[model samples]
Target: MTAAPPSATDVLIVGAGIAGASLAAALAPWRRVMLIEAEDVPGYHATGRSAAFWHETYGGARVQPLSMASFDTLACPAPEFSERGFLFPRTALTIGHRSEAGAVDGFTAQFQARGVEVVRMGAADVAAKIPGVRAEWSEAAFEAACSDIDVGALHAAYLRAAKRAGAHVATGTPLQSARRMGDGWDVQVGGQAIRAALIVNAAGAWADRVAAACGVAPVGIQPYRRTVIQLRLGVPVPAQLPLVIHIGGEFYFKGESEGRVWLSPHDETAVDPHDAAPEEIDVAVAIDRLQTVVDWPIAAVERKWAGLRSFAPDRIPVFGADRHESGFIWCAGQGGVGIQTAPAIAALLSAQLGATLPGGAIGAVDPMPFAPSRFA
Candidate 1:
C-alpha cells in the first residue's frame, strides 16, 4: 500500500523517476526527505519507457564523466544497495558510410582521446560482425564498454534504499503549488499543505512547470519524444550481436530475446510534457532506415513505444540550488542519459544538500559545468 503525504519535511522531492528516487536515497539518510509522485506509480513516463544503454560516448563529453563515474555503482554496488549488478555486457559498433569516413574518423578519434576504448574497423571486420554486406556502410568505430542497462532494477533499488532509509514515498500525490515562506517552502499537494525546508524540481519533462508552480523562473526545459520498436527479423538473431549504431545518428538496433531486435530512429521531436505514445510514422521511418542498413527482412513489428527526453536549453543537465530562489533546487534536464548517470548525479546533489561526498571519480569530476548558476 502507498503511504500518505507527510504534513511537513526537511526536503520535498518532486517526481519519483530515476532522478527523484536516486536523490531521495542519497539524502534520506541524513535528512527528512519525502518523494511525491503525480501518477499512481512512479516512473510511468520517461524512466519506464527507456530503451536504455550505458554507452560512455552516447551523451557527448559533458555527460561522459558522469556515466564513467557511475559505472562502479551499477556494476559493483555496495552489498547494502543490491546484491547483484544491474548492467549486462554488450559491445557497441558505431558505423558510417564510405562518404562519411571523415566523420567516422573524427568520432572514433574524439572518444579515443578521452580514453574510451574505440577500435577502428575496416569493411571486412564490420561485415564479420553484422553479417550484412552493404558496400556503402563500411567505416566503423567499435566500443567494447557499451552495455545494456537493467533500468527497472536500478530504479527499484534507489526507491528501496530510500524507503529503507525512512524516506516517505507518497503515490498519486502531485505538487499543486509552492511559495517561499521564510527559510522554507509552503507547498500544496494531495489536498493538504505541507512545510518543507527545500523543494527539488526533479520533475523530468514537467521540470519547468514544477518551477512555475514554485514561483521560480522557468529554465526552458524542453521535452523531446524518442521512439523504439521491437522487430522480428527473418534472419536468426545472433546470440552475441553487438549494438549497431549509425555515426550520422540515423538509427540504432540491438538484438533482443526470442530472436527479435530493438530499433530506434534516433528521433527527437519536441513536444509538451505528457503521456507519450509512439507515432506510426516514426515506427515506419525506423523500419525504412533499418532496411537500408541491413539486408535482414522484417518478419513482424512485435512491439513499439515512445518516451520523453527532457533537456535544458544548453543540453547539459541542471543541478544545484537555483540562482535566486532561497530553498529551491534543480535536479532536472538529464535528457536520455539519466539512468546511466544516476548514481553520480545523486552523489553530487546529496553533497550540495550537506552530505559528505566520498572520494573517487565522482568527487574528482567538477560539477560547475552542470550547475544551475550557468543558466542564470
Candidate 2:
C-alpha cells in the first residue's frame, strides 16, 4: 500500500539562524510555520560567531532605522520570552589620525544629518577615554548609544518563543530540492518531503545558493569573511572601556573580562559560503594594527575565529517578496547588522506576509529601500 503524502505548512523558513528563528516567532501566531536548518544546531554560522553589538550607524544610513527599531526589544525583552536581559550599555568611539581629521568630520556629519547624536572629541579626550591611545590620533567621534548584545541568549529566546508559539523547528535537516507544486512548494529535506505555501530564504551566507536551489533568481548576495581574535593582555583592561574603532576602518578593539581584549582587523575578504576559519596572517595584521592604536602589551593569543557576513551589491538588507515569484521571499543580505536588526526585520517581514504591523513602528519606516525588487 502507498503511504500518505507529507502534510503542508503555511510557511517554510530555511536557515535556522537568528533571522529564521525570529521570523518564525513573528509568523507563528498567524500561520503554521516550519523552520529548517542544515546544521545539527541552529545559529551555527554567522549568528553564533557574531561580535554582537548594536550601533545605529554600523550599516550606514540606509540600515540605521532597522537597528534603531530593534532597540526596545533588545534592551528589554518580553518577560515571558526572556528572563536574561540581552543588552548592556557600551559607548563607541571612532578615532582618526591627524591626516584623516576630515574623515572624522565627514563621519559625524553624515550620521548627525540623520538625527543620530554624535559628540566630537579632541585627541586629549580620546586618550583619556582609552588608556595608552596613540598621540597621532587627533580627532574622534563618540556615539553614546552603542551597546553590547548577549547574542547567544537572544538567539535562544527567539527559538524558544517560536517553538512555544507552535512553530516546528528542524535542525540537521538539509534541504535537497524544492519545486513549485500548484500554488505551493514541494521541498525534499534530507529524505522526507514537505510542502509549504511560502518559502523564506534566511540562509545568511548561503542565501543565493538556497534561492537557486528553489529555482528562484539569485539577487547577487555576496558573502564576505571577517576575522576576530581575543588577546590576553599583560596589563588589566578597563572594564568601562568603550568599543574603540578607527575612522579609516582599519581595526577595532574592546575590553572583555579577565584582562582580555577582543580585536578585529575589520577585514572584508570575499569568499564562498562555508565554515570559515581565520588566517594566520590576518591575526598578525590585527595585532600590528592594535599596536599602532595603543601601547598595550599582548601577553598571548587566547582564541580566534572567523564568520561570513553576507551583503547585497548596495549593502542594504534585502527584505520583501520576490518580484518574479511572490511566493519566494528575500530575507538575506543583512551584512554585519543581522542580529542587531533581527527584531525589526522580522516584524517587517511578518507584515509582508499578510499580518498587520503591531504598534506600527516598522510601518512608519520606508520599505522601498530594502525591497528585493530593487535588484530586479
Q: lDDT tens digits, residues 1-376, model 1?
A: 2666778999999999999999999999989999999998899999999889899888888899999999999899999999999999999999998988999899889988999899999898889888764877899999889899999999999999999999999888899999998989999988789999999999999999999999999889999999999998888878568889899989999988746889999999999999999999999999999888888888999999999999999998999899888599999999989999999999998999977896899898788899888975
lDDT of 2 at 284: 99
Q: Cα lDDT of all candidates, in order?
A: 0.91, 0.89
Clashes of each: 0, 0
**Runs in model 2 lying further than 4 Å from the true structure:** 1-6
Q: Please list the residue runs of candidate 1 whose C-alpha ends up more than 4 Å from where it truly belongs after superposition.
A: none
lDDT of residue 349 for candidate 1: 89
**Per-candidate TM-score against the hidden true structure:** 0.98, 0.97
TM-score of model 2 relative to the true fold? 0.97
Model 1: how far residue 23 lies from native, Å? 0.6
